[model samples]
Target chain A: MNLPCIVTALPAESRPFFEHFKLQGRELNGLQLYSCERCLLLQTGVGKLAAASKMAALLQECPDITGVVNIGIAGADAPIGTQLVAGCVEDAGSGKRWFPHLPPLRALPDLKSVVVQTHDKPETQYKNGIAFDMEAAGIFSAARGKLDSSSVQCIKVVSDNHSSLVSAIDKSQVFNWMASCIPVVDIMIDLMADPIRDQVRQVDEFTESAAQKVHFTVTQLHQLHRMTTQHLTLCSSLPTLYGSDAKSILQRLKDELAATPLSYTNPMVKDA
Target chain B: MDTIYIEEQISEHPRTLAILKRYPKARLVSIDRYNEVFNNASQNFRKQKQNPALILAKKEGERVLPTPDQYHIGGQHNYYFSHMLNCIYDCRYCFLQGMYRSANYVVFVNYEDFFADIETITAQHKKPSWYFSGYDCDSLALEPITQFVEQCLDAFSEIPQAWLELRTKSTQIRPLLNREAIDNCVVAFSLSPEEIVQAEEHKTASLEKRINALQQLQAHGWKIGLRFDPLIQASEFERLYGRMFEQVLSAIDIEAVHSVSLGPFRLPRDFHKKMIKLYPDSKLLSAQLEYNGTHVSYPESTEKAMIDWCEATLLSRISSEQYFPCVSS
Candidate 1:
């Protein structure tokens, strides 16, 4: 199965994109459908924290998501009307930075390697020398930790500048700005998503048969016993997100399955 | 259960002597003094030889010391401590094969001396210190046999400022659960994707099992850490990691997690060479990697990309303060 390439956007930034991709007249949760290409793009609300949480939720819901891209209007260092694909995201509060997995910017020399910094207020970008964004950092951070780095891409069009023009930019301007760059967004999405989609398909093919095969030895079973115990130690360190009953059921399954000696007749008893 | 025999030696090293004093009850099996059983045939797991593991014991004035790799765990503090050698698990890429002359485990029964020396050094330094276990052997792999973590936890608990980081791929948490959680102790588990764990990290717990164990400990109020060091670059790494992260987050509560550290695959140049020699056919060790000074690591671009991805993902789920990148100096 091909993992989805999730896109995070606000109500304004999402409307036009959803309209552009709308296929039959059906809409799901304010998100319109494109061709059933096995990609899931989500409108993860606005702001860094919300975007981060939404991205996490998306990843949890769709473990097969091949890649992630955060598409929005960014306040670039260049002219207010300029278009640029952000190559990295920097957190202003923390010196930590994230380099998005876009195609190498070698061909686009005019495009600035924009750093998208996140803050509580839009005014925080005055001190930093780049674009201001509410969600890129959160998306980048979430994608980076949950997925491989090469699978995250951030494409932002310059909607406003660090100048007083930033405050003048309203919700309508953000939508118009994102709408104008629909073509560039399409290009960026293809560039970032195509390779990852191919890779995910390959992984699915490989793991499918391997997942079906079950081969474990008695010695391996003994080792699995020790491994399960150690796994219990590692899990015990984390807080409980699920119910204790679920945890116990999973543990019991692991114990029983891991303890079962691997015989040719028992196809279920196999190596992980 | 193959056993490799060893000859005995008496050393005057204070730490070695001190350890021997604690293990007065341990039997000392001896071979010829001149025929140093340092590298037995069965013990050598070098790539060229496929032999059974070895088991060795010695009689000394106070300690039974095992030969340990000098700098096994790198990054925070340079430390070398080994209560035992060799793990119960037979990971294909493990350095224990090349670094050790034998695959047999050598458990130093002396605990008091190890603690004494640790206390002495800890007292000397005012800065918060870190003592790493699971270098020569997994700190908790053989918990049922030796109950080593129990003793070490007791010793580390006494020192207020000193920190003890028990690194392991094992899921043995019974001993940890039995004791009171220590403030200065951090129980860090080495994690990999389910695919990597199944293929390369042979004899290790499943990813789900490990996560469950981590969750249990966090619920019990233990400060737990996630170590995604030595991340293997596999096909569809993003999907693998994405699923892994989702699985972890859904199964684990983010608030209780103390810290998460991510590092790409790394190995000392010498250790890499030795490991390659020990496992010439190992796909993991044979992967294309560049040598950065004395260590073999992923290419700069790849490492940066992987680390960047992991850092971002972790920050989204947890606070930035909780994420640590194990960068080499």
Candidate 2:
């Protein structure tokens, strides 16, 4: 997976996030960009078209995106400053929608879950029981294909609501709410980042290095993977397992696996 | 407080009507189907878990069916079903957490249908069939609102050939205590060391409260079973568990105890991946577990030691006939 990209609709939305993270180099199109070791942050000016355009460009540059995080102020039927994770994001213009399947990451303690409606223009009327935003649908549409929907997350801090008490809302306060939520958004990105994928990479590296010493056919390699089954122990104990050289460990495990009486019903198998 | 999502099909259901009445302030959202919202791809489980919504839907499929062979609790035809999808208590080691994509509770409001399905299954076999509740969710934690335990007891009373096991970690035993206990039903309490319960079983009743609930139920003529299932492994696990048994056995009536079951903490390889990423900081999930075929768990030696210690501790209080070791016995 590529480094995660945090996309915001406004400069204020991106300002806090951009400041919080240390980025290395950045590329600019219409929107400003900042990137670091394995992540990128972009300010997708405002509205749906800008969001889609900037997202498309970001994906083009980094094809293997871990996930996309959309953070901005939104209008909802909740208290102002309340943070929400988008459960279902809908494009108000075409009625097209996307639902990002999120596995349990167990982060974002105080934020609520809400269905977000992405409007092309500023939404004044929040009659429906959903939060209103300007960019999630566009971001989701582009990111869903590149990554799992569960990895694609959107963090919205409520700036206004249908029954908002204040006649005039403070702009700086809106920016501040989004700014204060940078930590939560970062945690969400980290939570959504696949840990298993990282473990798989370690496994792949160990397996590849081990295979380089001995010539194993495709069938033998498949059998080895089947025997190991990506167990966590094998991943952590890779260094110890392949002592001195890869050939000995490879030959030993392979011999052991071949000798094991395979059974369908029994889950108890000898770990390599 | 969280929002409540309702399937349009069951908006008029009696249980749905009763739940809405109980939680009137909860924001209500109507969806065409439960999956439309429940299965949404963009939802964050961690965020939703903070304020999990309540989904009321209709059960259309087979509501009662046999459980996996490994999940058998001494029955020839062991079957299980859920009136709910997710549980109220957020146990870190619970299989439900890994099984479902969503943490939001989905209660199928069709209780009568579940019972009717059970009737069909029981009639097919003359031998007593075991029906396990709380496999997908807890049987009595939300009893005050769901009333699932009460409803299931009513149904089990009629079917003498049916044995209902209401497994839970809840301290809610007033309903069972107030009523005449049925011979066919067993109110099983999931037991773990106080330290383990405190660490992994989030939002569940404390060990002391659960022990109280157990004693209360046993005194009221309700058959009780202790489930040390999904037993977690640690450095001093045996010492902690042996002490726990002494405290538990000393408090409750050992002769009245019906059965004790011990199981190891294990999860599907895929689910283990999902859970580890979900709670990376969790010591229980982060423990260097080995993948055994399709499932991941502590190494075989560690698993064996835990069961042996726990079985010895339990056997000291009760007879071998009264105890069942899931993996070993």
TM-scores computed on chain B for all candidates: 0.81, 0.97
User: What's the lDDT for residue B76 in model 2?
Assistant: 94
Tens digits of per-residue lDDT for model 2, B145-199 = 8888888899899999999999999988878987999999988899877777777
Candidate 2 lDDT over residue span A143-205, tens digit each: 776665566778788888766733456767866887789778767667655554665566567
Q: Which candidate is the best by lDDT?
A: 2
Runs in model 1 deviating more than 4 A are A1-272, B4-35, B39-43, B46-80
Q: What interface RMSD do all candidates show, one decimal each? A: 23.7, 11.8
**Candidate 1 per-residue C-alpha lDDT over B141-199 given as tens digits, one digit per residue, 9 for 90 to 100:** 77776666898888888887667778888889999988779987778888877877777
Model 2 bad stretches (over 4 Å): A1-31, A34-50, A59-87, A92-96, A99-127, A130-135, A144-272, B21-27, B40-48, B286-288
Task: Tell me the TM-score of candidate 2's A chain.
Answer: 0.72
Candidate 1 structure quality by residue, lDDT tens digits, A14-82? 767666765223344443423335345677777888888777766665566666767787665667666
